[model samples]
Target: MLPSNTLPNPAILARPRRRRSPMTLGAAFGLVLALVGGGAWLATRTPIVNLGNEQQLSDSGLLQAWKDGAVIVMIRHAERCDAAPGPCLAEPDGITVAGSQAAQRVGQGLHELGLNGADLLSSPKLRTRQTAHFILGQALASADWLGTCDPQFPAEAMAHKRPGHNLVLVTHNGCIDHFARQQHVPGGERASGYASALFVSLDGSGKARILGRLNEPDWQRVLASSGR
Candidate 1:
């Protein structure tokens, strides 16, 4: 045996190195990619409006609020032409027959609340105009501000509000979503469905506040509750 103080041969003392498996590395890489992809999807997802349980407004309450000239109603146009996929520029896209019927029902609901005291405006889009006409039973004023998803549209609508008259805006989902974001309306509010109404209240200082949303189904509920 070598003396205890003597160094051993380097070759004999060296230990075998461990190698990582390609499968293990691949799994780790895939996991990382999945995590990144999921995060990106979450970031881009449409936010859901968080209207609390107590936020649901009764038909009478909403009607009274509108009569008081304290409400600004913004509704998305009904379903557009669905004959084919993708955008069609041949003619102005109009609402479907079902959508027309839905618009009529929406108009009936509003009429039950008395629309004579309301001023109506619509996006220049053919779909929106059709919806407005069906709902109000008359032609409405078209405004460029309502036609696009401009951040300033909400404020413009507020400015157009006349005393003793509620402002009714018939527009698209994108415009309403943009307006909600601009107003910093907090909630997990999902995309408003076709003909859904977003009711906003304006203060004496002309500040807009989102009161709540009334979906298409909710309108029926309100009508039933009011026995109308």
Candidate 2:
């Protein structure tokens, strides 16, 4: 007696209701747990570096390792001409020919790390400028951080410059000494045999951690790690 338009379609009525299987729900939950566990494990793993050795870090190699985000690199000006230590010889006349060559090595190391053209900063000392020019291949702006020649400057100014640009500094032993003492690192007994480079990386939470220390580090590994 009902009209065809008023009645439900036979095809719609004939279709069976389907329920989700319990197995499917279990599989999804397992997958979620596995992913979460894997992520947490990854977070706890230490960051790696490929320093073949301490004394062979090349400038080109290190450049490749340099990365974006906030990082600070400190280098003792390659080998200098100054033989004596005092205020009289404290003028900033940078590295000798051999020292410049060493700077080039550091520059090459920087390039290898991944910084094509990095933000160069330096102390007011001429040697620091020369070191920056040789290693970074550019004139760097002098910063109070560099002038302080204190390794703990970054620690002091964490709020202002902790998590910004990737920076490099060319300075003397005093900065290294202060940094080593504050960081609990032994730079060297005397200044003569104490050439080294220190790389510091800042995390998202603004905590700085030591990434590498090379009495003479391998630049290649440093560059590759930064890219990663």
Candidate 3:
């Protein structure tokens, strides 16, 4: 059986829960976050917040987590070449030119956050590798678990997190969502856009906590509000 996702804290899910009225099979399945563990794959749980909102970002404690070096940010790769009809970067499996530029912008956001004690990682696939390269101006260490997007994803992610050093992983939506579900993100907080980020932390207590999400275009606002 898949691991159950914990209920999100009241502040994040402060709103009242609605009674289930109806649902399509597809919609029902969408609520489940996928994970691969022990050579097997399964789905996991909650609600996530939009740190894109300036006020939300300021209140999210994300900056404090970064200051403490207890942060792991999962960035979904920028627009894939094959996903759109627009021009491709270099290969069909790679990202578009715009995607690369977006990656650079996101890098700047991370730069604003500081990277002195940080590690960069990416999925081994061409798209993810390319995304990480554009972000850091060089190739990042690639790993199978990063690309595998399996149920073991949560464990693998936690395993890669080093103390006193923030970590960044460039991966796919499914992988990112898996981690989100593990946190029990509400079904509504699921669209992790191209180059979007899901922020999380694992401190001394060894508990992984969700911080917030940052869509690609919200960098400017977040930076201004965060004062980082």
lDDT of 2 at 200: 64
In order of TM-score, best first, we have: 3, 1, 2
**Candidate number that wins on lDDT, 1 or 3:** 3
| Poorest stretch of ten by lDDT in candidate 1 | 46-55
Candidates 1 and 3 compared by TM-score, better number: 3
TM-score for candidate 2, please give it.
0.57
lDDT of 3 by residue, 1-228 (tens): 544566566777888787765676556665553322422331344457788988888788899999999999999999999998878999999999999999999989988999997988899999999899998889888999999998789889999889989999999998987887778775567668999999998979779989889998998767967677
Per-residue CA lDDT of model 1 for 1-228, tens digit only, reads 878669777876796787999999999999999999988867754443322222346522565577688888899988777653535323447877777778888887777767777888999889899899988888898998898777787678788888778889999887888778776543456368888888887777777677777776556656567555
- Which stretches of candidate 1 lie above 4 Å from their native place? 1-55, 59-61, 83-92, 186-190
RMSD (Å) of each candidate, 1 decimal: 8.2, 16.3, 18.1
Q: Lowest-scoring 10 consecutive residues by lDDT in candidate 2? A: 186-195
The estimated TM-scores of all candidates read 0.69, 0.57, 0.78
Name model 3 segments beyond 4 Å from true: 1-45
Total backbone collisions for each predicted model: 8, 41, 14
Tens-place lDDT digits, model 2, residues 56-136: 334324333344546667777666657434332234455566666667777777665556454566777777777778877
- What lDDT is obtained when candidate 3 is compared to the true structure? 0.86
lDDT of 2 at 210: 55
- By descending lDDT, how would the candidates be arranged? 3, 1, 2
